[model samples]
Target chain A: MTALSAAAERLRIRSGAYAGQTAGLARGHVQANLAILPADWAGDFLRFCQANPKPCPLLAVSEVGDPALPTLGTGIDIRTDVPRYRVYRDGVLTEEPTDIRDLWQGDFVSFLIGCSFSFEEALLADGVPVRHIAMNRNVPMYETNIDCVPAGRFAGKMVVSMRPMAPRDAIRAIQITSRFPSVHGAPVHFGDPAAIGIRDITKPEHGEAVPVEPGEVPVFWACGVTPQVAIRTARPPIAITHSPGTMLITDLLNTHLSVL
Target chain B: MTALSAAAERLRIRSGAYAGQTAGLARGHVQANLAILPADWAGDFLRFCQANPKPCPLLAVSEVGDPALPTLGTGIDIRTDVPRYRVYRDGVLTEEPTDIRDLWQGDFVSFLIGCSFSFEEALLADGVPVRHIAMNRNVPMYETNIDCVPAGRFAGKMVVSMRPMAPRDAIRAIQITSRFPSVHGAPVHFGDPAAIGIRDITKPEHGEAVPVEPGEVPVFWACGVTPQVAIRTARPPIAITHSPGTMLITDLLNTHLSVL
Candidate 1:
């Protein structure tokens, strides 16, 4: 069969035909981390995201009970467009499903959080090496002791993703990433794992740990998973999120996110 | 006596009346690191600075054997405008003189390099705390294992100046400094000393080590001294440089260096 268009790709996802990871699908478009919370809890969560923008940069927010996110793409139905979703009950993971049509609720508010895929593409295009991508593994993530700016009902330490590069490449990565503030701009910490509260550089809190070669430094960027950590801490009555690595692809170009 | 205008300040230095450190002298203008060499070595040195722009960002170059630098300021004489000068014989420090008039050679070539003071002012204006500035000490610097891109007769490990700050502030600092790439730009390394081959965090090779708080991370920027280290390794027959902290004040505003 011919490759599906972006809209058709979402349609196939909604129909349970393509339920795999969305990492390289819908090339050149923006991909987002999905978060669906009850309207009663969303105000505080929005404040939380606004306060800690680097980790929870909000790209688009749906109205109360609305499933369609018009700002992100045409006919983008948040309830079913993503390839996979995880349902939470009182901040506990309850189900992982290919679609959320049966689980959709009128009180739900959907938020599209910026993902690092955009910035990674920019880095690669700029000739900067992305070790995790080259090694075919998920970016290594660590929990930092650094606290996020607190909002009512949302508070937790920050989480960061790591990639190893030479000092000069790391510097260039910083400059390139700073232009995309919505995608966890720049890096939170670099060089030392212990400096940010990670005791073991060889082990990571989440994802696979990649090797940092000799003469290379480990560069860390604030990860989008940070908000999920905060949400778990908040312990809301109900919440839903995209399954790991299954993001909501939108029509927006990654370049559109750059402030410059 | 009335306060010396910037031009008057330069004139005073030129006349050998003001020979102290140039810090805080030309409040709103740019100050540059000066390097003078024989015409035979000028091409290679210029290529070196161009190849490794971070530590040796060239601001202006004087005509061969000309004492005056027109682009930097009015009636600015490179041989006498700087408050202090270091004369080197065979790449060894011989004398720290107030002026180079008596030792001036017809084959001399002068280069002005961008200094960190420009970006420090930008940071301070943005409310970012500079630890060294706050403590009234020089920025702590370390020679790293990371090497610069080699140019003819110019190859050495990069040298970096350090400042300790909380992780969050460091992120903001990266963004602010990235705007001014002409001046060292963003940090080279942060977090761990061992990652970059430094054995001890508290003991720096140059400048006094400052305090690193419990939650703060040490941020490192490429230092202008990298070129000096490379020059020392090259071991030229004769070289001249502005004494540390005694730069050639220019007419350019710090904001004029911003790439964005």
Candidate 2:
């Protein structure tokens, strides 16, 4: 097991002592996708998550104007605990900061979303091969013609992460991943990219494309990046999020996320 | 909404009052895939199902030599409850009989396997369109190159039932089906059949092929027919099964099978 205390790891991140991606850090804890918005946009975004659960699976919502996320982890100061934060103004990224203390607003609300990292760990534990991880690359992600259930202005086509596995492994992966409903659950699609309006399989919208072998089929899961894409399209006056790959490590055990 | 009384329906089946398929009979009640074997081959088949859950999800096992399946329904006699039964001798079907009372042996062991009907109801309830159901045909099934976990003399490639759906509905279907693991949990594959060694999309080894529309991908689920194929390969001296499309209607509610 990876030997790292989740709380101590958060402290390091908060102190600006750690600024790298949180992918392999705090191993067993539930790492969340962070999305901070002004109190004005919080209600609509929350409803959006409720409507499109597979993509924007909401785990926790911070109290309005609160900086500390008590439910996710102890000593988690949302403003400083994330290794990297992206600040957006009118939907355009204006700054990338290691800490957000100077920009903390009294009317801001933070939303923690379920991330795929936890489910990937479950798959690996079950001896399923994660192609991208083995090749040391980010998972291949595609923007699909599949539309998310709309809620007010928060609307956009769904984005999905793809992994290729043999038929047998794909079946087992479906069963295993189904246990973690909060983390995108089972795959959204598998096989032909064109079937989902993905014109180019090798050319993904975000992340690097991994090799899909002769007998392997590409399995796509509803991605957390979907909410980010939607947020960008909605053009919120101000928004904050952890830079891609930088996540908030929570105290909740990954196993605790399994419904069954 | 199907208006058929359980006992009256069984009486109809036994008296040749109903000659049609039992697909939607006794809605809300559990319908079982029947597999009757002589005492000698029963143990091995039991072990096979325990080893390979996806293709052979066993819902009930009867006492050796007993034709009565009490757990499934009240006063249910396996030999007469089903509309029709196929009698196999030395692994080949020798007769299709309406009643197996005369053939019932004291050494026979009956196994009730979970059928996709349970989960299909779930998917439809959740607003996922099932192509075959909409088209009024049997689900398209294919023999995949994927092998089932072998046990004793029971071993063969898995059989899968296919449905065509858009990516969004496919994801919802996965979540709905996952709750009924006993009825083949989630899909084994979706998209290209060639990846699973199914060369032709228009032709299937069993069941009718439904049209896959431009934007819809073919989703394949582990089929109950898989065990029947395995059992045939074993060539047991004496075996009996409900005729294809003619299932044993039981009192067990479909909701009772949901794991989540």
Candidate 3:
């Protein structure tokens, strides 16, 4: 889009002019992990997000059967704003679509969960290097032994995203990321891979692993993938999520997400 | 004193009835690192402390030739309130005294500095175990390679206090301590000691080393001793400080120091 405004970017996505990861796009504005479920499952899913905020920090919830998330952005249409979407049937990936306009159900409820991209922008601005961004790879993520508090049928172990940093930078990362509790807050763990039940540091469960340097430590933050793990366990009849790295553009500024 | 009120404790020290470490005595109050210098050096020292806040966060400063630090508490006598004192003459330790009343000078200026004891209380309240407290030893202190911004005559590498914690606790400690910027907020360095120019983790320049467990990483905070190092290097003709572990307790609640 010429303007590159969040709404402009969304309009481009809606028109099928762009269908790619939203990580670095729409810089300074908030990018959200999209989750859509039928009206019947919305309450329990909302509860899951609230109960496990480190993994699923809720930013906005749309009115039942309405796509507009007025609180997050203007004239937003969840079914078409995100560049890419993963539609699951009975918790199994059934289709990948650029726009979900045709698939949208009148009873669908949309949830906008906080994304790490917001805080990654904050970290980069503070001169902290994000390894995945520097490497041009998806942040390596692993399923952790830490369990999420159950809400109805939505419950599972946590999944965490990894970033390798020198101890000094990691300390700085902790301080900077803590300002945005909505975007995973401070790191959950660091150092030993096996301590958090990851069998191998190089073999992450999701995304590619970048080398943690000789003196660098691996810092882990709770990942939005955690909700996907819970959804897999719950085995809902229909579930829709933004494909990994593909996020919904919103009007909220990254700085606005900072709780402090 | 049978009562643990900060005022009562300060009264005992003022009366020369107590002359011991202030740790755990005034559990909920803010404790300060005491520094006294000739009036001529006070402005430079204040500037040094302001420039290197992480190492020398200034909480309160008494007017020149004044023994009263009324801002810190009711009638805080800099010359006598601390349990024990170290008097240095031309950079050399000349006396260790319980009361400095006889030595008080009309041209002396008193500086009250933020102490780690305040954040340690915050950490313990958050259910984080402090190893030095558990082991009944002093927290290990190390000299770092990171240089302080030189101000007038005061300049030196920062001295750091080490507390070994599992990654989780260290992260939580960073978040909790960050709220108290006046008390050397967050850690300056963590993980490898060598990275910060600390040659040996087991050997510390000041204080006793406690055991660091297998999964634990040594977390380092900028120490109050940093100013002591600078002061020693500056070699002012007449200087005084509270002996290590002996502090000036104040009426401010530790909770009030938290920014959030």
Which candidate number has the best TM-score?
3
Which docking class does model 3 fall in?
Answer: high
Instruction: Give a tens-digit lDDT track for model 1, residues A48-155.
Output: 999999899999999999999998888888878888888878778889888787888899999899999999999999999999889889888888998999999999
N/CA/C clash count, model 2: 0
Give per-residue CA lDDT, model 3, range B56-122, as digits (tens): 9999989889999887888778888999999988778899999998888899999889999999998
Q: Could you give the DockQ of candidate 1?
A: 0.40
**Candidate of highest lDDT:** 3
The number of the candidate with the highest DockQ is 3
Per-model TM values vs. the true structure: 0.86, 0.87, 0.94
**lDDT by residue for model 2 over B66-100, one digit each (tens)?**
87777776677888878888888877989999889
Residue A93 C-alpha lDDT in model 3: 88
The backbone clash count of each candidate, in order, is 0, 0, 0
Ranking by DockQ: 3, 2, 1
| Model 2 error, position A148 (Å) | 5.0
Candidate lDDT (C-alpha), each: 0.86, 0.87, 0.90
RMSD of each: 3.7, 3.3, 2.4
Model 1 alpha-carbon miss at residue B154, Å: 5.4
- The regions of model 2 sitting more than 4 angstroms off are A1-4, A40-52, A63-65, A144-157, A195-197, A226-238, B1-4, B146-155
